[model samples]
Target chain A: MDFVLDYISVTTFWTVLFIVHALLAVALLGALTHQAVAVWGPVRLASTPGGSAPGFVTRFRSVFAPSYAGVVCLLWVLAFIFGAIIYTKYRIYVRIPIEQQGLFKTLGAFELKEHLVTIGLGLLPIYWYLWKNARNAVYDSSRKWLTIVLAAICWYGFLTGHVLNNVRGFGS
Target chain B: MSAAAQTQSAPSDRRRIFALVFGVSFAVLYVVCDMAALPMFTYHPGSDRIDLGFTPARPDEGPAMYWFGWIATSALGAFVLALGAALLPQKAGAKIPLALAWIVPIALVPVLIYSLKFYWRW
Candidate 1:
């Protein structure tokens, strides 16, 4: 990869990319968590019997939930791209040797993580649609269910990626 | 909404449900197929290395057959399932989300099994 800054070394290039990917993943984790909570455990305002006004966090979550679709999709895809770049170095240095060592569980975790990332990408469009139209009562159940499933996928990918990173640090 | 309007919207609603089912199921099914090593086509970059008739010089440096093959396999699977659901009667179509609520989770089982199988050598 050609560095825009001549002073930047190849190691720095990849390390920066890894850092950016990590940041994006962290943001995605927060967005999905808030959205999931909003869907499955919405808080009602105690002051109102009709539940017309939700509590502060619940109100924030509701606003945050619908807005997350676009941001999550963008960041997730960008993270995937960064990961693909990082994977080239990882395959030879980290993955192959680890596999040779018979540490299949860690390898398997990384494998699943990659697949889940791609699968989540595939769900992006529908996820956005459901969130965009969340106010439509008829689609409420579908949206909630989809939100829960996507959040589950994100959590799976996040946790697995963390485990694999611990097993073998990125781009080593 | 009037009764007539509700009736008119029913088919569209069904179509939306079918679309959602296809999208979500395709994603899950694709990964499951990949995890289970059920690629319709095989190309190991390090060995023989010819996937879909394309060869990469090194196994470590080659096209990812898991990706292309998974896309092909999952697309076919999702297409067939969606078509079947689309043809179901209107009442049956309405149940697609409910069906998926359970079906998607069941579809995830193979991924877990595949991961464990490698670890345990079972």
Candidate 2:
């Protein structure tokens, strides 16, 4: 116990958590991407990806949208929860330096990213509801659009976090 | 329909109303809170304190972050509104346009981007 505690300093602990956060975000990005594409137009997805040798893109967009609702919501919440935790450390270390160094664009992008993600967070419940009701024609339009919006948010967030991590976290 | 179907429908109806109301209201309220800087609470990272309303860097601390509080404000306010919407008679909810779920937030995207105009390069 003493040796393990000594080896993993606060910095190491935060770094590990940061990596976990990034991994969760990546998983979330993939899940949302697949759902968004599949939910378009006809608002249909294969019950079991049944098709006659569909192309890469078609196969990519073939997941059952309803099955994804719960997972997407869970991942979104987990990703944000982990993000909120590491955000405290980020404010103290990375953000202040980024400001002092005059990386306004990068900082600004993150600012936008945070707001967008928060908006995306607020969208989760409805996204879940719409997807759950995907079979009902009344919700089809709302389902498609909401999925696209959530996907867009996840993409922007993943990209911004990637770039910022490149500037900071990836080094370790 | 059967009794089971009728029983299931009401709660699901209320849930759909709640989710949609929460979605639309949170988006609108978040933008207002963020732009106005009227968060439910503010977190000063340096001092390790979360104060109610906005506060400066106090005696010895770095910048204060209102982002968390902004989220809190929108979420809590939207929660109250959603509960009310869900509790309303089903007839009242039927009048709500489903498009508003995605539409309002989608429209506000640009406004939010505009709000961050301070960070724009040119």
lDDT digits (tens) for residues B25-107 of candidate 1: 78777766765666666545334244552233454464344555666678678778767777778777775553354346447
lDDT scores for all predictions?
Answer: 0.67, 0.83
Tens digits of per-residue lDDT, candidate 2, A1-172, equal: 3475587887777887888899899899999988888877333445656547657887787777689899999999999999998898798789877777778788788888888888889989989888777656666667888888889889999999999887766224
Q: Write the per-residue lDDT of candidate 1 for residues A35-136, one digit (tens) a residue.
A: 888888776536666656555776656655777778877877888787776765666567777877788878776776676666666666566766677665
C-alpha DockQ of every model = 0.25, 0.46
| Highest-lDDT candidate | 2
> TM-score (chain B) for model 2?
0.85
Please list the residue runs of candidate 2 whose C-alpha ends up more than 4 Å from where it truly belongs after superposition: A1-7, A41-52, A170-172, B1-12
Which candidate tops TM-score? Answer: 2
Please tell me how candidate 1 rates in CAPRI terms. acceptable
Model 2 steric clash pairs: none
